[model samples]
Target: MIQAPGKLADATVPHIITELPGPKARAQIEFDKQWTSPSVPRAYPVVPVRGEGCTIEDIDGNLLLDFNAGIAVTSTGHCHPDVVRRIQDQAAQLIHYSADFYLPIYAETCAELARIAPMTEKCRVFLSNSGTEAVEGAIKLARFATKRPYLVAFLGAFHGRTYGSVSLTASKAKYHAGFGPMLPGIFHAPFGHVADLKWFDEVLFDRLVPADEVAAIIVEPIQGEGGYIVPEDGFMQGLRKICDKNGILLIADEVQAGAGRTGKMWSIQNWDVEPDILVTAKGIASGMPLSAFVARDSLMTKWGPGAHGTTYGGNPLACAASLETIKLLEGGLMDNARVRGEELMAGLRAVQAKFPSVIKDVRGIGLMIGVEFDSHERAAAVEWGCFQRGVLVLEAGHTVIRVSPPLVITEDEVVIGLKLFGEAVAEAATKV
Candidate 1:
């Protein structure tokens, strides 16, 4: 295995034993069924026993090349030595339970975030335990800051599964089925349709909600779960103008698209406009339970003491891991993502060209990618086929194949993944 710079991971090779979800994992699943809710879907059967660099070994002794990156959470790769060392060091020193109390690690981590934030002129950050919690905090901060109840989001956006974030999510009904009555006054507009930018500017806003009553316009720079849809050139600028005119906060939900998962530090950096509020999670801590909602200090002041606080939010262990993760990403991981992403995207496009009937579209930025097919059945077939072969991928929306590999993945691994993906596509074509 080629060793990457910055020494984020250990120098070692990956090996496989069993297929996946070996007998050990199957038994664990049975145990999980007794305690866990079935509504939470599982994509793979392999139970990871250990991970190093860009590969994970399951309990069944199967070594699978990771392409999903733990659903885009482990951008730096599984069990990076630096991150793991940080976590272990912090755990031994102090496990947790500070609760917004004075902590050096927390302060340092927040300062690092503020330094790298899009608009740092007067920015502050509130740390949380997950992406959904970050979303919840963003909405609360916006509503409390503006003293308005209405929050405007785009269609086909997946914020999170919490009640507040669920209300903002417009693409899937299953996320909110029987979970409501959801938070009211949330409006959704058709996400910028490049085909009809004029309507998005002239008519869509009026049809959804007059800009006057809206408190915030929450969006993802690149819609992650909404099939990796990238907005047109002028879309973000238009939204920025709308927010400026209406006094609405622009909250970019970067939980899936941020933290170098894309080439840039955050997906919003690709656009000229900046968000008034930013919510991020997933890869921020390199797989630790860390998320944050950052905003201008003036807007963040809306939260009075105890207005929004979580018991385990911003614990020292998570902050320690996050601080190291930030250093690693800033050092060179992002550059690797951009370079490897271009290589992988080029390969995927070639595959798309070769299989016109099976592949409909290949689109995404940096390492966050999606391959769209004509139907979900075809997408599932391709996913199952890839899994059977060895590479692990993910499916999103109705017919989109999502591939978010660790930023540290080598070009050869990507080539192997594409080859496996091509095999899956060919098999899928035969079935069709």
Candidate 2:
């Protein structure tokens, strides 16, 4: 196991030293308010100065247990020595080289991914800077390879904020409000509801876009921003069958649920279903700005030279970090996610038993757990309570609390964090 950095080795977690939004943090927030775009969302105003493992220290010297993990991006924890060492070593050697040209680290990263890719056949990867870019690439590849113009995505799915990705995203109306005339030939279906899946065949394909014209069906193995909803058994299998029968591509949007976040290397692996294309980011590079869409060699080969590319998609530094991140995941972090996830879910269920009225649902796979409240207001209150207690969490969909800590979180940390979370829920329940 990688050792903690010296500075964090002795720091007590969930350590609150001053009032939240402390002087320093307030100043930063004010300055950010003036300079940063208002479109960006802010959960709680705990300005972090540094982080190690699952602990984040704010400018006021208050230590908070980070359960959000930067929205599930830090799979291996903060400043993992192995990942940091790789970044440092790679930065010293080479930082940026156009991925358009060959780079050893780039090739190594893709090779490593091929080993763990969900496809049984040989897979090829298209690297990009973020999840949205990966999705955009997948869109293009799917259309080009299949020669189809139509696409299908689930309602409440968040692919990205870029033009094409935003067009595909249906999580919130505000995302596409005034964006208007989103790319044509895209359809939305209900997520995780079997009736909606049936509607696709009996209604959508029959009355709307024909199945032959559809290029791909993009879906999150476990919806992230939607509600961390895990679909019922056979849901994925049914989708795979549909795609196979129609010659349509299955695009698994594993951006938030992949990279060991769901206990497996990829969330789709849990269902034993192989997607035609897998788009991933978030935790792929242990917080580095990198994403990739992997596809079977046959599909990837159809894309001609210069069909699609990015300038910094496969930066050497990011690739090196990814190599180390994958090593850490395969080494032991995935197992930790599985074991700790079960323990965390059991604790959440117990908390739900205490406040059944407040918590409507609790569901997840591995560490990507969610606790749904009866109302958005109650969920927000619980979020605030957790923040006051120095446990950082994030709200999902309309009334769900996402609990996606770094995969490296220990059993002791899980116990402490959940205790605070339970207390927060109890307090929020009283308010409702």
Candidate 3:
């Protein structure tokens, strides 16, 4: 069984050694503001010095329990020994010969992905550096394979920030306010609503864009960034049936919800439908920069070799980290996620019951959970409260506090974190 590092396997976490954003952190924040791009959002002033498992130490030596997992990127937890060892060993041997020159680790990573990808037929993977690149790759492959000109995406779905994927992203107005005209032929429908699907079939296909012209319908099984909104039953199945009938591809954007975050390899697997393309990243390489777009072999084969390619797509170091990450996830982290997620969700529901006015809803699968508040100000206050108490959390959409802890978080740690979260909610209740 996979185990957290001995130092971090215990409960007494969120140990605050100094005030939040203590002297050193404040200095660093000032330096960062001066040098860094203004576009990067800083939810809280957490200047992390180092991390192990579910705990991160700030520059002032305050140990904080990390529930955000670096925005759900560290599935196996921060600095997992096995993953780190693979990275170290691979770095010593070969860091980046580039996939253009055929690395052995690339083939190994692809083989591992094929073994786990949720496809009945043989699968093919195209590795990229980030979630945006993965989505872009999927878009190109779908359009080329289907020979279609249009695409369908859901409202509140965050594909990525790149040109092509950004066009498909409808999560927030800020992400699209100035960046238009977006890529043409991309249609947006309400997320997790069957009526939207029907409207697409009856109204859109009949009038706006013909079904035959559509290339793909991209969706997030559990909407991230927008909110941790799990679709009602039959919604995903309906999309699958619609895609099957119309020859339009179903692209599951699993960037934030996949890689064992939702107690499954891919969140879409929670439904009984199979997507034509699956885009995943964030937690794939245990915090390393790696993303992949997987599809059926037949569908992937339509594009010629040079039609889509990347220089550092499957770097050896990243592939090694990914291979070890898969091993850890398959070994025991996935089950741990399910158990701890249930425990965390139950605890959050109880907390929600105590403050119904503050917490509007609690929803998620596995460790990928969200607690909605009455308003954005309330959510922000609660998040700040958590941070002050040494538990790091993030705001999703406008009013949801996301609780995506590392998969390797221990049972004791979950209880402690939830307790802190509850306390934060109570504190925010009075202020808000």
lDDT against the true structure, per candidate, is: 0.84, 0.91, 0.90
- The true-versus-predicted C-alpha distance at residue 154 of model 2, in Å, is 0.4
Candidate 1 lDDT over 334-407, as tens digits, reads: 98888889988999999899988788999888999999998899999998888877678889888999999988
Give the range where candidate 3 is weakest over 10 consecutive residues by summed lDDT.
2-11
lDDT of 2 by residue, 189-223 (tens): 88886555797788779999889999999999899
Poorly placed runs, candidate 2 (over 4 Å): 2-6
Error of 1 at 125 (Å): 0.5
Which model is ahead, 1 or 3, in terms of lDDT? 3
Residue 134 shift from truth in candidate 2, angstroms: 0.4
Model 1 is weakest, by summed lDDT over 10 consecutive residues, at 5-14
Q: For residues 1-432, write the lDDT of model 3, one tens digit per residue.
A: 756465744536888877888989999999999999999988989999788899898898888999999999999989999888899999999888777777889988998988899889899999989999999999999999999999989888999999999999998999988889999999998778666678786778988988999999999999999988889878999899899898899999999999998888889889867889999889999999999999999999898769999999988888988999999999999999999999999999999999988899999999999999999999999999999999999999999999999899888888888888989999899988
Give the TM-score comparing model 3 with the true structure, all chains together.
Answer: 0.98
